[model samples]
Target: MYTKKNYTIKRMLSWTRRYIFMFILLSTIPVVLYEVLDWKWLHLPWLPIGLVGTALAFIIGFKNNASYGRLWEARKIYGGIVNASRLLATMVNDFITNEYALKDRTDAEFFEIKKSMIMRHVAWMTALRHTLRVKKPWETTTNNKSDQEVMKKLHIQEYAFTLEEELKDYLSKEEKQAVLSKTNKQTAVLNLQSKAIKELKLDGLIDDFRHVEFKNMIGELFTLQGKAERIKNFPYPRQFATLNLFFAWIFVALLPFGLMSEFEKIGETLNGSNHTGILFQFISENFVWLTIPFSVVISWIFFTMERIGDVSENPFEGIANDVPITTISRGIEIDIREMIGDDKNEIPKPHPEYEHTQM
Candidate 1:
C-alpha cells in the first residue's frame, strides 16, 4: 500500500521512534548498573539469548507469512470483482433487447432499463464495500492506539460518509428503503438485482438464455463477496499473534543484558593491550557504552517486523494499507456508467489519494 519507491529514513523513524525510546531506556539500565554501580551479576550469557532469538525469528517469520497470505487473498478477491463487474456491465448493455419483448417499447425505454440495471449494480458494489469496512471487534486498525494515531494522518473511504447517503445515489427511494430495512444490506441488493433481471426476462426484454447467463454472473458476484467476507470475518489465530508479541519482547528485554558484556569484553581486550595513542585509549574505554544504541537498534528491528505483520493481517479494515476496495468500487462505477453512455460529470471521480496511497 505504501507506493513510494522507498520509505525515507525519516518516515521509518517516525513509525518506530516511540519503540526506539523504550528500547534505549530498557538497554541503558543494565549498562549503568554494570559500569557505575559495579553490578557484575547483571549480565546474561549470549547462548540462551541466541537460542531465544532464533526461536523468535521463526515465530515472526510464520506470522508475517500468514499475514501476507490474508492480505494477498483479499486483493485477489477484489481483482475478481473488478473483472466480473466489467463483464456484468457489458452483458447488461448487450444481452437485453427489444426483439422478443412481450409489449412494444421505444429505444429510450430500453436505455432506461439498461441504466436502471447498471445503477443497481453500482448499488450492490456500494453496499458490499460498506459492509466490508464495518469495524470488527478484532480489527487492530480501530482497536489499537498506535495504529489509530497512524490512521489519523490518512483517509479511509468508509469513514467519509454514512452508507444511507451514498446508497441514495444508486437506488430508487423504495429500493433504498427496502435495503435499509434489511440486516444484510449487500445480500438484499443482490436479491433485488435478481428479481429485476427476472422481471426483464418475463417481459421478454431478455430472452431465456440471456436470463440464465445474467443469473450466473450474479452467482459469481456472490461468490466473490463471500470470499471477501470470509477473510474479514475470520481472523488469524490469536494465540500465535498474542504470544509472538510476548516472545519478541522477552528477547528484547534480555538482549542488552547479553550484549553489554560482549561489548565490554571487546573494550577490555582493547585496553589490556597497549594502545598507540590517547585517542585510541579513550575509544577503548568508552566502547562498552555503545551497546545502548546497538541494543536499541537491534530490538527495534524485531519489534517493527512483528508490528508490520500485526497490521498487515487485515486488509479491509478501511486503513490506508488496506486493499483499496473503495477506490476499486468507484472505478467500476465509472466504467459501468460510461459503458452506458452516462456523462463524465455524472460518473463519480476516483477516490482521492491520501499520503500517496489511495484507499
Candidate 2:
C-alpha cells in the first residue's frame, strides 16, 4: 500500500514511533552509564548483544510467515465467493430460460421477463459486494434513481420509495417496527426475487427442471455467503503471535551483555601504547559503536518485517495491502448487470481515488 519511495521513511516512523523511542532509550542507558563511571570496559557488553540478533531473526521469520498465511487465506475466501456468485447467477438464467419455454405468456413478454431477471441478478452482485465492504450502496444519485426505476419495473413497489418519508405511516407500533427491522427489510427483498420464480413455476412460466436448477443455484449462493462470513469472523490465533514478538525484542535487548567479557579481558591483558594496543583497537572496533550499529540495524530489519506481518493479519481492517474487497465487489456488481443485459452505458466504474496516498 505504501510503495511511494519518498514517503516510506515517514510511514515507517509513524508506525513504529513508540518502539523507536524505546530502542533509543534502552540503548542510551548503557552509553550514559558508561560515561558517568568513566569505564571504557563497559562498551564491551554491546558485543554480546550481537548474539541475540541471531535468535531474534528466527522468531521474526516465524511470526511473519504466520501473518502472511492469514492475509493470503482471507484473499482466497473472497475469490471463492466471487466465483460462486457468478456461477450461481449463470445457472439461474439458464434455468429460467427452460421454464419460459413452457409458459403461457407471449414470446415477447417472456423475453422481457427473462431479460429482467438476468439484469436483477446483476444488481444482486453489486448489493452483495457493497455489503461486504461496508459501503453505502447508493454512491451516486443516478444509481438511486436507476434502482428505483428498476424496482418499479420488477413490480417490487415496497422497495421503490422515492425517499424514506414515502414509507407507509398507517400502521400500528408493531407494524412500524416491522418496517424498521434490518432482517425483515433484507428478507423482504430476497423473498420478492425468490417468489417471482416460484410464481413462474405455478403459472407454467418455467418448467420443473428449470425451477429446480434455479433453486439449486440460490442454495449454492447461500453456502458461499456463509463461507465468506466464517472466514472473516474466525481469525488466526493471537497467543502464539504475541509470545513470538515479545521474545524477539527481549533477545535483541539482552544479547550485547554476554559478549562483553571477551572484550574486557582483551583490554586488561593487552599493554597500553604497545603493539598489542593497536592490536586490541583493531579487535575492539568490531565490538564498539560498530557492533551497536550492527545490532540495531539487524533489529530494524526484524521490526520492519514484524510491522508488515501485523498489518496483513487482519484483512478486513482498512490496512494498506489487504484484500481490495470494496473494489472487487463493485466490479462484480457491474459485470453481473452487464451480463444480465441491463443499462449498457450506465455500468459503474471503479473509483480512481479509492487507494488514498494519505492513509
Clash count per candidate: 0, 7
> Per-residue CA lDDT of candidate 1, range 199-295, in tens?
9999998998999999999999899989989998999899999999999999999998999889989988999995678988988887879989999
Identify the runs in model 2 with alpha carbons over 4 angstroms from their true place: 1-10, 35-59, 98-180, 183-193, 255-287, 353-359
- What's the TM for model 1? 0.95
Best by TM-score: 1
Candidate 1's displacement at residue 336, Å, is 1.1
Where does the lowest 10-residue lDDT sum fall in candidate 1? 350-359
lDDT of 1 at 247: 98
- Give per-model TM-scores: 0.95, 0.65
Give residue 203's error in model 2 in angstroms.
Answer: 3.6
Model 1 lDDT, residue 142, Cα: 63
Error of 2 at 32 (Å): 2.6
